[model samples]
Target: MARALPQPRRASLRRLYDPQSGEELDQALVLWFPGPASATGEDLAELHLHGGRAVVAAIETALGNVKGLRPATAGEFTQRALMNGRIDLTQAEGLGELLSAETEAARRAAVHASEGGIRKKVEQWNDRLLNVSASVEAELDHSDEEDVAAVIGSGLSYRRDCIALAEELERALASPSVERLNEGIRIVLAGPPNSGKSSLINAMTGRDVAIVSAIAGTTRDRIEMAVTRRGYSYILTDTAGLATKTDDPIEAIGIERARQALDAADAILWLGDENPDIASDASIILIHARCDEPERDATPDDRTPVSSKTGAGLSVLWEKIEELASRHIPAESAVFFNERQRRLITEWKNRLEAAAQEEDLLLVGEQLRLARSLCDQITGRAGVEAMLGDIFARFCIGK
Candidate 1:
């Protein structure tokens, strides 16, 4: 009627069996963790078993038969950890961010949060604002009505401090570093009809991601591929060749899509050395297609002439493109990798700005409180119940 408790931390050989049939399921290493040191600040056990379907299914079936033992729900263990105060909301959000990270830059940013990068900064801001609030509160509590000018002076000093913090937040949120890291750098291939835009993307990716053809409008749809070059992720898009007039409706739609892609691009590979007059701050690398073709200038001073057929200038092109991608990746900044974090940060910044401008000390303190609440939301504290269902639901069972 009793089970032996396995040694803590060290894995012990154990055999799992089906209770109904008394059949040995499989041998696995069972490790037991007890008490406050455990991840959830409670007793936890881990069963290290072979991966795959049949083995896992057998073990799961056996576990279900045991009295008073059941399977964990999605994110249950992590949720337990959260409830136990083992990790804060920022770290919990970071865990979610790390789970969904698709790129190296994104993974690194998420790691920063999980390692308390965000919490540290938020706590620092919290301290500063609390100190400011306390200063204002102290003046309000003071009995001396004679020194009215002194209170105004103290208020002015507090306003200056708030202004400084607001500007700092402004600069941090102004740069789209988080968005760039999360979305990856978009590099679009755009050019005139039969200008080898598709061919260039295929060559750049070193894969047949796009169809290359001599026909003017063969590529009637946009093809996109995410590629990692030099430890950086880039989204390479091959669009239908731009043409002033097209009789085919599909081709016209593709061309319009191409324009949209270019507009959204972080960097554009303008094939055939022609500017399409698109308004974008994105880097435009004029690429001259078919350098090996006859009746083409081999040396264009402004454009990078590349022959996809011969693999000319591709190496240099990648280096140039990576340089552009790196510009989007910032160093030493508090990055918000998801839309939720971005929105919360934006709200925090706006509230801080409003707090600085409020004439009444009580209103200014309230604004700071509201701003801190926004920061709290970003890190997963207040206003979390509304989002927990959606966020934790994404995690698989036993997480």
Candidate 2:
């Protein structure tokens, strides 16, 4: 049997918390509001609580005891806010992100989003789409009196605007790189054995994280650590060195994993002791490691010279990392992040392309509707109960 918890209490008007503990207790109470003066045009009850484990648990117990009050799901409060016209969909998503943000860049991005950056754009597109839908409906209704060409021309103009908006949405979704910005940037270090990869990791993180040894193949696995550089979070992965011949099976596996890391990384620090003959790969920033070595002359035009021993060029390396991190910032217009958003945006793009190529009014209307729905999905304006639940379920119970 599940344990019963207390119901959450309502705070008093003009004051939120009692002076007993200088903390608000989570308990059930009711206060009256004579409304032509309410914020939402309705009498509102404010809930205040002590942000403590026991207090929240007690509140939940109290709420469970009550008949009407249920625990708010992920975005439920925001959903209610939206329904009450307190905020739009974009602002809701932004608030969600803001609550989860761990870095300065992410916080800024979330704030920008919550301020209706995406909402305004989405609303503009929706307005254009609504116009197109109206024109199509008018054509369908007044086909008897209206000239077919004139109606078609009007519909075409609106369709063109819809198509343009779709294209703009697609570009915004792709350009912002929102997922990477929301989550920390992924950066991996790769090089041949004994090229100071572990040392570099330690240097960049300002900690002696990995086992630093002169022995080749010292690091036999992908060692990952979180680092904050210039107030931005980054997942820096130090992978095993890439080498062809290794006697140990473990070392061989580590090498394979290193290759996979390189393939999967957002940016790769291709380290080398001396200038090794290696082709430049996309998304790779070549780094000449062990600059302290007297004999080694590894220096490429694009490669930054770094010495983990004396901490030389580390500042420059951080600058490089920051530069790469900036590329993934989520812009105001971009709302896409997960697979759902991607699929919807792709569908929208496909429909827009189809509408541009085809002259069928019905087909165009259908595509526009699909595009609008997809845009709605981006802001959780459309049916998103399941998604909202999933997103909120991932949060802590009291969040």
Candidate 3:
């Protein structure tokens, strides 16, 4: 490796000429990073090579011939980073999330976690837990005034802190904003046939993603388009019109699918002049679509009037949906965006809650140790060797 460098210890451009075959593979700028400062806390180098496949293949083949040289598997570099304390488990996973992020909201959350924000919070919790554990362990060892006071004091503080943390965990588990960033918030367009559901969806996305037809039951299935509104991803679905007593098998199937879509939606845009009195717990924007060409008994206060063709009241309906989504998530939350993180954190929180109720100092100390172990698992301080391959497999090669 030293002989291949253009200079002894400094980064510089170098040309790769095969020693045995006398063939020049490529020229590249290379930087040799010494141990303890690199991403993996070991000696590493960055070879900024040209992306030509032949050049890359030749280099790889040449290196493969060396006794100790080998190719990196997917996310192997990141796993090395985790193993060497260069980055914790959350930050390592965050790197994967950042690479896969599909929306601005998702990117924001991923970047935050990747940059050690979650690690900082976890460190604070570990410090507090350690203090409580020490206090409990002391109480277990002896029965004295000082030990009793320490136990009582630590228990009170731990109770207050654990309750706060539990509340935060519960809120994070329930919030839709963070989870929807990946799955995408589903907003179903539902109403009678020829009620302009397709046209409204097209207008919302500013693209003709759904077929706009005047014929009833023309759209026989859910036509979903990924719509980005204010940087949040939404699956805007235009479904078959809902009505009773459909003799056509296909139309009936479409209606059943539409009902299924509505059932799964985060919000419903009930578009029509007639209110069908459907039972739903979801937030709905009752939109009297096609108001520009309308005949009805009276426009209800609960339902907004809009026309996709004329672009009337559409902005107001959009505002309503945006507001609903924004209100669902907090401005700043210590939320775990993925299920794996949520599950581990929830386990830790549950242990803390259980430990809070135990009166015996030895039992309480054991529970706290178990709770700390869960946090250790969350940060990959313990018990993660088996899953390392699975975790890093999602990453790109050489990362």
On TM-score, the candidate that comes out on top is: 1
Mind sharing the TM-score for model 1? 0.88
Runs in model 2 with CA error above 4 Å? Answer: 1-42, 47-76, 134-163, 176-178, 273-281, 297-302, 330-342, 394-399
Model 3 residue runs over 4 Å out of place are 1-10, 146-161, 176-179, 244-252, 274-276, 294-302, 329-335
lDDT of 1 by residue, 140-234 (tens): 66626558547655564678878888777776676665446756789998888888888888887788887777778888888999887555778
TM for every model, in the order presented, reads 0.88, 0.76, 0.87
- Per-candidate RMSD vs. true structure? 3.0, 6.5, 3.2
Candidates' lDDT values, in order? 0.79, 0.69, 0.79
Model 3, span 146-169: residue lDDT tens: 757665665655566666766765
lDDT digits (tens) for residues 295-383 of candidate 2:
76657676788999898899988888787766765323345444455566677677667766667777777776776787787667677
Report the poorest 10 consecutive residues by lDDT, candidate 1: 330-339
CA-RMSD of model 3: 3.2
| Model 1 lDDT at residue 129 | 75
